[model samples]
Each structure stands twice: as C-alpha cells, then as structure tokens.
Target: MSMEKISIIVSKGSLEGIYPALIMANGARAEGIEANLFFTFFGLDAVSTKRSGHVKIGAVGNPGLHLATFIGALPGVSGLMTRYMARKMDRLDIPPIPEFIEMISDTGAGLYACKAACDLFGLTKDDLVPQVKDIITVGEFYEIAEGGQIVYT
Candidate 1:
C-alpha cells in the first residue's frame, strides 16, 4: 500500500536524536507524502526558539559515540562532539536545524508541539519557533494521525 501520510513523533532533545525525525519528515514531504511532526517531551527543545540552536549531543551513555562513559561525561565533550557533527553535516550540505525546519514548513508539512509537555516545561506558544502550527494534546495528535503511519523517533 502507498503511504499517503506520515506522523512523526519526535521525543528526543539531543542533536543526534532530533536529526532523524527532521530528515524523515523532509524526505516524506519530498516524496509527496503528507507529513506532520509532533514534538513531545524533550523533543520540544528542537522547536523551542531559545534552545534549538543550543541543543547538544548526548555523549554520555550514548553507545554510538564509542567513547568510554567517563570520557564522554567530561566537561565540553558534548559540545565538542556537537560542533564536529554540525560541521560535518554542513559539509554534506545539510542545513542547520532552524533552516531545515523552515524548508520543511515551506513544503507544507505540519509542525506541532505537545500541550502537556509545554505545560510541564512552562512554555507558551510564543516560546516555540514560528513554524509550529499549534500546541496539541496527545489525543489531538492521534486524531490528526488517523489514516497515517505514526513513527516514533
């Protein structure tokens, strides 16, 4: 069966964790599949105007980092790795998070923030990036996701 739509649930706050959802959403849009991104829990950081740019890699306890846990926990390690990855992604022509969000939005994909998470984090609609269409409950998300595949990233 063809995928007419997709609903991506982004629940991670780390740079690495957030990129996959962004990429998948962008790719789906490029393929002419209706796409939506639901930012919940820690994932809300990716849509936070104040914190998006500062989101760092979670080096400690991240198996993909390949560094010893103690070494990964060292001060500046997460920042250093985040910069390195960002530079590499730039070289590969990947736009930064904000730009990527703009591009995806321009493609007519939906972007939403979790209302519960926003309440827990003391964030109002103004606290999120302008691209976010609305802050919604999980029930609302599921309603919108009806007839589409829901992917948790």
Candidate 2:
C-alpha cells in the first residue's frame, strides 16, 4: 500500500498557527504517515533559529492579546500558558511544537523553506531553522503537493 502523505503549508506568524502545523505534522508521523511542511510567508519566522526563540505570544492587536498578555503578566502565568499549550497538545495526542518539529525532521518528513518568501524577508538559507531540508520554489512545492492532501494552518 502507498503511504499516506500530508503536506502542511504554514503561513501565519502567530504562535497559534505555528504550533498547530508543527503539532499536526508530527502527530501524522507518529501514526506512521508521511508528513511534510512548507514554511512560507510570515511562517518562515517561526522556523528561523534567529526568530523562533523570539516568537511572541499573541498580544497587542491580536484578538487574544488581552488574554495572552494577562496570562503572560500574571505571576507564573507564562509557564502556565506554556504548560497549557503543551497540555492541549497532549489532549489531542500531539507533541509540543519544538519536539514535534524535531520528530517530524527525524522521521524524514520533508521540511522546506520557501525561497521566494525567504528573499522577501531578506533571509538567506543560513537564516532558516537547521531542520529545513532545502530551500525550494513554489513550483517545487506544488510538485510535492500534487496528489496529496494539502493543509494550510
């Protein structure tokens, strides 16, 4: 039987969007499915080593900003929020984003940086996350996206 392949296209800059793609992609691999992730647009920052660590919890102009800021400002709320996100993933049987990305990479799920997007952001291949398998054009991604489920999160 052919393996089930799922391609996740991550395009947002928020933690909510970034984490879900990583979690789902990794969850697919845990079940022995072939999963791939294409990071483009603002989503590229989520995977960039220089930017990933600085990823902000949604706040200021974000719909959830108040809640996120409240949680972030509360004593121990930052840790709590972090744990809450992790727990939510656990409830869904998915792993945390960082670990999920690691597992997805380790399991051979294709991880790619969008070259055009990268250029738009003034980023070089070296600026991307180390997990990136390659820098590819949209056409290349479409080639892989063919005949497979494509998800944008």
Which model scores highest in TM-score? 1
TM-score to native of every candidate shown: 0.98, 0.76
Worst 10 residues of 1 by lDDT: 94-103
For candidate 1, lDDT tens digit of each residue in 36-117? Answer: 9999999998999998888899999999999999999999999999999999999999988889888999999999999999
Cα lDDT tens digits, model 2, 1-153, are 665888999998767779878878877888888888999998887778777755544543445535654555666655555566666768987654556666679988999989999988898878877788888999999898787789999
The CA lDDT at 62 in model 2 is 49
* Candidate 2 clashing pairs, residues 3+ apart or interchain: none
Task: List the candidate 2 regions with Cα displacement exceeding 4 Å.
Answer: 1-3, 64-98
- The Cα RMSD of model 1 versus the native structure comes to 0.6
Residue 75, model 1: lDDT of: 98
Any idea what lDDT model 2 has?
Answer: 0.78
